[model samples]
Target: MNEQSISQNKIENWREDRLPNLSGKCFVITGGNSGIGFEAAQMLGRRGADLILACRSTQKAASARMMLEATSTGTINLVTLDLADRSSICRASDGVRAITQRIDGLINNAGIMQTPKCQTADGFELQFGTNHLGHFLWTSMLLDRVEAAGGRVVQVSSIAHRLGRIHFGDLMGEKKYSSTKAYAQSKLANLMFAFELDRRLAKAQSPAIAIACHPGYSNTNLQSSGPTGLLNMIYKPLNALIAQPSALGAVPTVLAAAGLEAQRGAYYGPTGFFDMRGPVSLSHIAPHALDLERSARLWAESEKLLGISFLSQD
Candidate 1:
């Protein structure tokens, strides 16, 4: 077989026979109450991985927990986390620290999609602040715990990133904004963060690894939520026809978080037509995401904007 074919075969085989026994492992999943995050949590929970669902809603978290408890072989816990709020992120991190000393995996899965223009509590573009900066801060706070367990940090990006470019001159879209472009930029930031974090971890000789994944065109509330007008009108019908189930969409994320075959700095997603849905496999990383100079600048800018030195010791 050719190299690509060989890799595909290995991934297929690994999915079937080499799934890890996740007993004793603990994972923290943002937005674990619903959609792709919940589905990914289910996959890990089935393998005996203890999970903490960090969500914005207590009611949703409780409902998800009740459902998860019926099927999961491992502990199911909850913590309130509002990614739009920096104080909430800090509190959630503290809540996680109280629950577990070491997290085997930290899944940065919660995000807002193409929403109308707005700003976060921290005065950043809502999508960029919540999707990228929020996770940025949370991960920084929890890095020591993850490193303690030689864990993996899985960042959930998106195919929208393919068209994204960092607007360094107007990072927050303060002058003018398009929701689509803003969402794309945030997702791009997510992927670039994973790569940059992996490089930093290796340089520091840290045992923890960083990986990225996308869910392709998953049928989830994400399409219904946040988006309005034309975007909503398009996605609703398009999703019904072409989108995969959230369970299938979440496979790449589950792999990145728990699969032994997943590699540091790698990206994973469905390998089907237009990458909408199919078997889990390595996905394309946009050239902009691979731009080392831009990625490093983003890292520094993130620290400056957040007013914190991220991983300074490392």
Candidate 2:
């Protein structure tokens, strides 16, 4: 079908439902203070899931916790996690390990958009570092615990990924940086990691599923963080007219996290126009995202750049 027709069908079919069995599950949602992440956390919490709100600011995390507690029937905890820093990721993971023996799910939801050109504490491009590498290390560090509990890992990607292309030589955007290109590249990395992880899990006979979802022009704080000036002006109105509400944007994530039929490496997103808005569905996967060679190379490069090994020492 043509792209226009495909998107219209998706918007028309959107729906939501409660998954009662999620009551005892444990979930960690990064960037849970606002936007799609916050809504996803709220929905899961309402269904009785114990949540860890991972954010860069403790103050925001605390506020989010209170909001969740006020609106949800389950438990919520705050944990400071700066995804731009590898050490911070380690510290947060250790903290989670100290308190809980099992982690049923992890939503790699924290990300930055078209911010000013910058580098992370780890020296990688800011968007790439926080959006992909940080989450990669966090997942690797928590893999054993997740495996023991037979958990799922959800990578919150974006439909913008369709326009992304990885520039291996300039991965850090050292030569030049366009905020939009960097943001898209980082998101594509996320998609690649999710798919590659699923393949690795299957090969190792691991029980965890690595799934991906996109929010499709959701009205979230992400749009507010655009590069400013003409770009912001352009995005603002476009988002206002076409973006879904944060609650509706959380559907694909909820489906990936708790849906009974969710599968490893499955991609989910809105069914509407160009996947920028609609009902949840099994979304199309980009061909480059499924390239095993690229995935493996990216995995190796990620480990090297982060100075962390994903495989267990044992």
| Best of the candidates, TM-score | 1
Error of 2 at 233 (Å): 1.8
lDDT of 1 at 89: 93
Each prediction's TM-score versus the true structure: 0.95, 0.93
Stretches of model 1 off by over 4 angstroms after superposition: 1-17
Ten contiguous residues minimizing lDDT sum, candidate 1? 1-10
> For residues 182-294, what per-residue lDDT tens digits would candidate 1 score against the true structure?
99999999999998998899889999999898999999998899899998999978998999999888888988899888777788888788878887788766677888889
lDDT of 1 at 292: 84
Local distance difference test, candidate 2: 0.82
- How far in Å is the alpha carbon of 280 misplaced in model 2? 0.5
lDDT of 2 by residue, 177-266 (tens): 999999999999999999888878877889887889888888887877756677788878888788889898988888778776566677
The per-model lDDT (C-alpha) reads 0.89, 0.82
lDDT of 1 at 285: 66
